[model samples]
Target: MKGRGQESFVSLPRFAARLYNALTHTQAIERQHREIARDLVARLARGRLLDIGTGPGRLLSLVHELNPELELFGLDISEAMVHLARKNLAGLNVNLQRGDIRSSGFPDDFFEMVTCTGSFYLWDGSEECLEEIFRILKRGHSAYLFETYQDFDESAVQKALKANLQQESLVRRLVTPRLLMSQLRMTYRTNEISDIIKRTAFADSYTLDPTSLGGPPAWLRIRSTKPAARA
Candidate 1:
């Protein structure tokens, strides 16, 4: 989903957001969210954390459960998503905002950790967004970007489908796998993503983790740190 211009800022509306909330409640998705939360909490056990494109807010919920002392924040381009996330995360101490990634409305050097999952591909002006991430993240902190990848072996795809979607409803079992596979074809390959990250300050301090999700080879993680070279 590489792109340029206004089309890059996509958001899910009320109905789509509701459907998304339901569809993503599978074991596979939950496992992915848990892994991401654990990795972030392990790296920065207690600090402000910002989750961009926080659809349904599942990841932040997990983070809070893992470490309730950490301050949590979430940003999404869709108002409906923000509302749904708020309802889902009711009683939790989280700050949810409606905004765009290219221009996150936060102070520079503000957050200890930043994360985006399954939504990085929809971003337009990705380099600009990366710069924003670098600017807001405190020096020596990190940002983890997780997205579906396109270069998995066919057997891996089949195994993932069986593990993640086999017990789903007939419609979901049939439609979800096909939808995911199609998007997989359209997503960034590891090298393409590497090239893009290479254009930003994170280039010097980033590493790719092919098995970050700890399940199928369906997702790729790009962990980038802001250098502590400057004060």
Candidate 2:
């Protein structure tokens, strides 16, 4: 399962990358996630912000637009995705890199805010990745992780697909209910996600906010913070 999940991102073809960017542009759920992430970064982000698994860099671009003064960076495991993101974010005052989240190699207390969306479920070493995120984040700052649950709204997904693939019958046929369900199986439940957070450095310093994400019940956002040093 881990190998398959890793392959899904690492081997993303250029055509598939274009399709993903188009879907995010047209899909309602994807749009909402981007909007929420942008708003959160705009409000809470200061100094430097890093976005993990920033496929195509749409959310990072949005956040940069909202907070033009913010220093933004993006990392993705997929070289293809990073290429696409670099193209999408060209001349936007953003830094894009290709790397694994488990070993980001950034300095400690680096970013004021961090975010990961839609790709958290693909992480095979989630605990290590969370710990890496915790390490890079400045003390008292936060990282937000967004993922879809097993019971995520099927209707919205179908609607989003239909809206995005209106002219591509073959694409619509490929995105079947069975395929969606199978993909959902790769994701962790809300409690399971919380448990993963508890095992990380952010244990005892995180919030599982099911209501804050503002989408389907199965859509969850985990806000985890690194504590400030004792005085």
Candidate 3:
């Protein structure tokens, strides 16, 4: 049997696509509604930005709108999803590439800022992954990670998915929420994730819920920095 570590890369790309066509064909559109009206753009002003797990690139579009001069690079695991993001965001000055954030090949101190939305919980190597992000980013560069906080256990869910993941496309998967939920081995609490980030070497790590923004339950944001002394 292959390991979860070996399979995480494969599962990530399919997660968004399958969730869309499988769970809800209009998932992207639904996400657009909540995000466009949300504090995501206000939190991520402009200039050099790295968008991790940039599913379909709606957040990219929003950031661009917030500031046209924003130089944005997007990375995701799904090639097909990248295509959709490219097509959906045509004529805009953005660089969207297919890559796993776990190994983004950009040089260190490259970006002024970084952001991930709806995908942080999917990461298998949390501390290591953040260290990589910290490595590539300039000191004091801000990062925003928005993910589900109220409904699941981050570890157990990923563990189960890493085991029985089907090798299929979104059109083929038609992945139901029930099917996905069943794979989850545990439930997650916000403080559980909060404690993980707070204990990391990264400073200023904190969680912001919907109450922090007067919004919905699935909303959560973490703001952090790479220690300037390391520079």
TM-score of each: 0.92, 0.84, 0.68
| Candidate 2 vs candidate 3, lDDT winner | 2
Better of 2 and 3 by TM-score: 2
Tens digits of lDDT, candidate 3, 62-148: 677767777888887777668767976899999998877777888988888888766666666676677778788877666777655
Clashing pairs in 2: none
Model 3 — which ten-residue stretch has the worst lDDT?
Answer: 210-219
Clash count list over all predictions: 0, 0, 5
lDDT of 1 by residue, 42-126 (tens): 8887889999989899999999999999999999888888989999999999999989889997999999999988777777888
The models' CA-based lDDT, in order, is 0.84, 0.76, 0.62
Which parts of model 1 are misplaced by more than 4 Å? 1-11, 212-214
* Candidate 3, superposed: residue stretches over 4 Å from native: 1-40, 43-45, 151-187, 203-215, 229-231
